[model samples]
Target: MPDADNYGNPDYPAQLAEMARVLQLHRGPIAIASHVDADGDAVGSVLGLQRALRALGKPAQAFLRVPNYLAFLPEAGEVSPPRAQLEPGTLLVVLDVDSSDPLRVEGVAIPSGAELVLNLDHHGTNSRRADLSIVEPGKAATCQLVKELVDSLGVPWTADIATPVLLGLVTDTGSFRFMNTNGAVLRCAAELVEWGASLSWINNHLSQQPKSHYALLVSVLSSMEFHFSDLVVSAQINQAMLDSAGAGWEEAEAFVNTIRSAQGTELAVLFKDYGDNVKISLRSRGRVSAQAIAVACGGGGHHAAAGATLNLPYLEARATVLGKIEEQLQIDGLR
Candidate 1:
C-alpha cells in the first residue's frame, strides 16, 4: 500500500496524502457514515466527503438521517439510512465519530463486509482500530481535515462541496465564537468562500428556528441550577418538555452552549432525560476539561465540550454527573 510509506506520520499533511493515495486506489462502492444525532460538523463532513468522492467518479453515498434543521444543507436529500449490508468490496468511510462503539455510531453496528474501513475524526479520545484511521485531535473540525483530504484527492472544489465543509468549520467553532476558533480556521473559512461557499445562505438557515424550539428553550432555561459560587451551572430537558412544546431532541441542540454563556460559569451541564437513561452534555471553559468529566462517566469528547449517557434515572444521573463536575472543578481549584 502506498499509504504504508508514511503510516502514523506526525505531520498531518503527509497523513492526508497517504489517505488520499489509498482512497484513490479503491474501485468499488463507497459508503459514508457518521455519529448519530448528526450535528453540523458531522453532517457537513459526511456530505462534503460524499460529494467529493462522487465527483471523483466513485459510487459514494452518505448513510445517516439528516436532522430537520440541517436538511437544508447542499445535497442533504441524497443521505440514506444505515443499510443492513453494503455492496461487496465497498470502502466504508466513517467520519466525525470518535470510536467504533455501536452506541456512538449512527447505526446498530458498523456495517460489515466492506473491502476496507477508513475512519476519519478530530476527537482526542478516538482510538478506533479501523483498517485505516486518520484521527487528528488538534483539528478544529473534521471538515478541516476533510478539506485537506479533498485537496489531496485532486477533486476540484465546487460550491456543493465547499459549502458543507465550511458549515462544519462554522458550527463546530460555534460560528467562530468558541475556544477552538483560530487563525487556521479563519483562513480555511476564507478559502472555502473563495471556492464559492455561500456564507449568507448557511448563516440564514442556521438563524431561523421554529416557535417550538423557543418554547423548548424556555423550559430548558427555567430548569437551570447554579452550584459552587455560580461557577457550575446545570439544566435539564425531559420528554415532557419536548411534547409540551411540540418539539424533538433536535430542538434541544446547543442549549448547553446557551447555559455555558452565563458569566463566571467555568462548567455548564445539560441533562436530557431519555426515559431509561439520561444524556449529559458538558461544556467547560478555562483549565477545566469537559472531556475528562465525560470520560470518567464512560463517554468521550474534546476538552472544551463532551458528553455521556448515564444509565440511570434523571435524578440519579443528575446527581452523578454533578458530583463528577464538582470533583473536576475542585481539581482545577475552581471549587
Candidate 2:
C-alpha cells in the first residue's frame, strides 16, 4: 500500500507550503511552462496551477504549444506560445516535465535574472534542474500533487480549479484503471467531483475522436506488428501519415494505449517518425518495466509507462528499442 501521509513523503506538505509562501511573497509576474505534446495531466496541471495563482490575485502567464484539438479545454485560449525571452526576475514554474533543461519547458528560455526556478512533477526521471523541486513519483499524477499544494495554501477550491485538476486525475489514471490509482488518488478524485468537476464533459472531450484522428489511428493500426509470440505489440507513424490524416502529434496520443490494450499482450510500443529523430512511447503490463527499458535507451518514466527519443532512422531505432525490450523480458523470464 502507498503511504497515506504526505502522499508518500512526510516532508511534502511542509515543502509545498513553503513553496507557496515564497510564490506569494514574490509578488511579481509568474510564468508557467509544461511539456509540449501536452496530455491531460500536463494540460490540467498547467491550467489548474495557473488558475490557482490568479485566484490568489497573483499575475500569472501559462505557456504551452497548445494543440488545436485541446482548445475546448477551459482556459485553453489563454495559453501563450513560448516566447524567445522572459522578463528578468520572473518566477518560472515548470510543471510535469521530465527534464530540467530549460529547452524542454516548451522552448521557453529561462531569463538570466529569474528569481527562482521551480519544478513540479511526478515523473521519477526528473533531472532536478530547478532551484526548488517537488517530485513525487508515487503520485498518480502531477495534478494530484498540485491539488494538495493548493489546498495546503488555503486556496478555496472552485469549479474552475476542480475541473482541470480532475481532468488530470482521470487521464493520468486511465480513468482510475492504471496501477498508480490508489486509495488516496480515488479520494482526491472524489473530492474533486464533490467540488464540481464535470465528469461527463471531461470524459467526452478526452475520449471523443474527430474523423481526422480516426484516420490517423487507422494509419497507425494498419502498421501494427507483434513480437515475442504476440506478447509485444508495436506500431509506427511517420510524418506523411500525420499530414495525410490532417492530424498532429497530439492526435496520436492515445495510439499506444490502444495498442497496449490488445488481448494477451504484455507490452506495447509506438514509434513516431519525426524526421530528425524517432519518438518512442512505451506501455506495459506488470510483467515488464517500461521505465527500465526507456532508461536503457537514455529516456525515463514510470514502470508501466515511459518514453524515449532516438536520433536514428526508423528501422535502426526500432531494432535498438526492440532489442532492449527483449533483453528486459528475458531477464524477467518472459522470453
Task: Please provide TM-scores, in order, for all candidate models, with all chains considered together.
Answer: 0.95, 0.95
TM-score of 2: 0.95
The models' CA-based lDDT, in order, is 0.85, 0.84
Each model's total of backbone clashes:
0, 0
Model 1 gets an lDDT of 0.85
In the range 201-308, model 1's lDDT, one tens digit per residue, is 999999898899888888888999999889889999999999999999887757998899899888898998989999988988857999989998889899999999
The parts of candidate 2 lying over 4 Å away from their true place are 1-8, 110-113
Q: Candidate 2 residues 191-288, lDDT tens each?
A: 99998888898888877778898889888999999999999999999889999999877777678998998999999999998888888999988889
Query: Candidate 2 has which clashing residue pairs, if any?
Result: none
- Model 1 RMSD, rounded to 1 decimal: 3.7
Any runs in candidate 1 off by more than 4 Å, and if so which?
Answer: 1-9
